[model samples]
Target: MGRTALIVIDMLNTYEHEDAQVLVRSVREALPGVKTLLERARAADAPVIYVNDNFGRWRSHHGEILEAALAGPRADLVEPIAPDEESLFVVKARHSAFYETPLAYLLGRLGAERVVLCGQVTEQCVLYSALDAHIRHLDVVVALDAVAHIDADLADAALLMMERNMAAELRPNGDITFGDARSD
Candidate 1:
């Protein structure tokens, strides 16, 4: 086995969208698990990557994106898992983190053969990203409790699809492992 990375997807949100109410509820529940994974990954010296949507901000970078999310109405939600200086960030324009982004290349460079996924929109971004990662031959593990969703039904179905079709390992955040000294 090579290295493993923790990929946090679309957690930096303004929550100013159509499904904000529903999504916010799920986010609140997932927050603690996401925080735990972030701490564990950092402590073990494992790669922590924040692959976030750019919100169509063509010129904005990660810092600007983070600032905007923090300044939003739901700053409380964004603050807890905000990226640290050591966290690698990839600004994505689409649902899948691997879509038109440098994420695949970055993973390659980091020697990360396996990726542990967490963060929001389980039925959307998280599901799509997992498929992309699977097709790219990278092992994928989704932290179930650490992912928020807009629709519970769809989220459940997505999880089943990821495990049944994509062969993704679906596990709770606490059960996730970074391997070697990083194992927890």
Candidate 2:
């Protein structure tokens, strides 16, 4: 099998605030699992790509994420972590990373055929990425604990949907590491 890539969508700290944090949605609960995957990917030298939502501002997403994170009392909150010099950062304007983004080319260049999709608003961005992965015929898996949304019930529903309909295996965070080549 080809090497794998871990795509983390919209896991930045900017969305962690209460107001902008989506009262009915959040990925905070998934942070631990997401972090675990990141650490493992880093250790294994696997490509860990941050597929950030440009949020429609074509010119200033980097600043927008920062401004959103630092506005008002949120300034005291942790800054949205910058993509490390080592990791790849792909800013996306739309829901799917494969749309209007070089993500596909990047993956091709990386020689990765398997992808682990994880991140916030499991019903939204995460859902879109999984579907896109399936459409693209890439081997896709959605990390279970590595996803979050404010509505716990809805989040669970989304997970079930992905499992049954999308063929996305839900692996609980901490139960597995990414460096392992086995799909399980």
Candidate 3:
């Protein structure tokens, strides 16, 4: 059993895009599960990493991003899952959290061998991050109910690909536990 960390990807979203409504709906459905996972992870003393998109704003910081997101149409989604003071925050320019980001180095520094992924765009960011983690030889576990997708069918395909090709575990939020009591 290795050290574990929880990666919350791209949840601090503005949700002002064309498909924002669709994405928000799915995120809303997953919010409860995500929240529960967060609480459990904290209780287990696992590190919480928040990998967020910069939204093409190279000069933007985390506070700015949070402010913009909370003031946007889907504040409901971003507000409830706001990162706490102890959480690690990383900004990424691409879909994959490791692409052009310090996520891999950060995870290594934290001594995290197993990563549990949770957040938005299941078929996009979450999927790409999972692939990147797999290539890094890190054990991956994706919280099935904690991820949101714009397209249900595409998300399902992505989940299957992750499970088959990357040997990633796809489990629901209730089944995930960290530290000594972790089942992964």
Candidate 4:
């Protein structure tokens, strides 16, 4: 069987943008579920890849990004889900994790045939990343409760599209089992 990886996208946010408050609230609501999923993935020894937006800092490294987020207003969100030493980090310039990022190559290197997407902005980054993953012929799974969004209606629509168009599996965090049981 192929390997599985958990893609945590845009969770290291500063919450300083236009709709930051809304997004932060949603993220906070989803924290418990996301945390549980993280623990399960780690325990299963599944690869945890953090895909974050560079926030226009072309030269910023992961350390710098972590520092900025930790010092910012949304530190609660960033701190709880901070990438550990064993976790992989990828900086993306766009909504999709695969867009101008090394995510695809990294997944390939890890022999990741399936990816569990969890994080913020469900309608944007998660949706786009799912699309890209579909195009790459990778099995996509979205943790419904582990992802937060700025708009509820749009996020629901996006999830529906992913299910119908991309055949992405939508399941709650509790239902997700990493490693050998992932394919089921």
- The numbered model that scores best in lDDT is 1
Q: Kindly indicate the candidate among 1 and 4 with the higher lDDT.
A: 1
| Tens digit per residue, CA lDDT, model 4, 1-184 | 5788999999888889999978888998888888888899999999999999889998998889889999998787887888889999999999999998889999999999899999988999999999999999999999999999999999999999999999999999998888763457
TM-score of each: 0.97, 0.81, 0.96, 0.97
- Give per-residue CA lDDT, model 1, range 1-97, as digits (tens): 6789999999999998999999999999999999999999999789999999888889999999999999999999999999999999999988999
User: Cα deviation in Å at residue 111, candidate 1?
Assistant: 0.6
Per-candidate count of clashing residue pairs (backbone under 3 Å): 0, 3, 0, 0
Cα lDDT tens digits, model 3, 87-107, are 889999989999989889998
The alpha-carbon root-mean-square deviation between model 3 and the true structure, to one decimal in Å, is 1.3
Question: Cα RMSD (Å) per model?
Answer: 1.5, 3.2, 1.3, 1.0
What is the number of residue pairs that collide in model 3?
0
Instruction: Give, for candidate 2, the lowest lDDT window spanning 10 residues.
Output: 73-82
TM-score of 3: 0.96
Cα lDDT computed for each candidate against the true fold:
0.93, 0.70, 0.90, 0.91
Pairs of residues at least 3 apart in sequence or in different chains that clash in candidate 4: none
- The local lDDT score (0 to 100) that residue 164 gets in candidate 3 is 100
lDDT of 2 by residue, 108-131 (tens): 898887788877767777888887
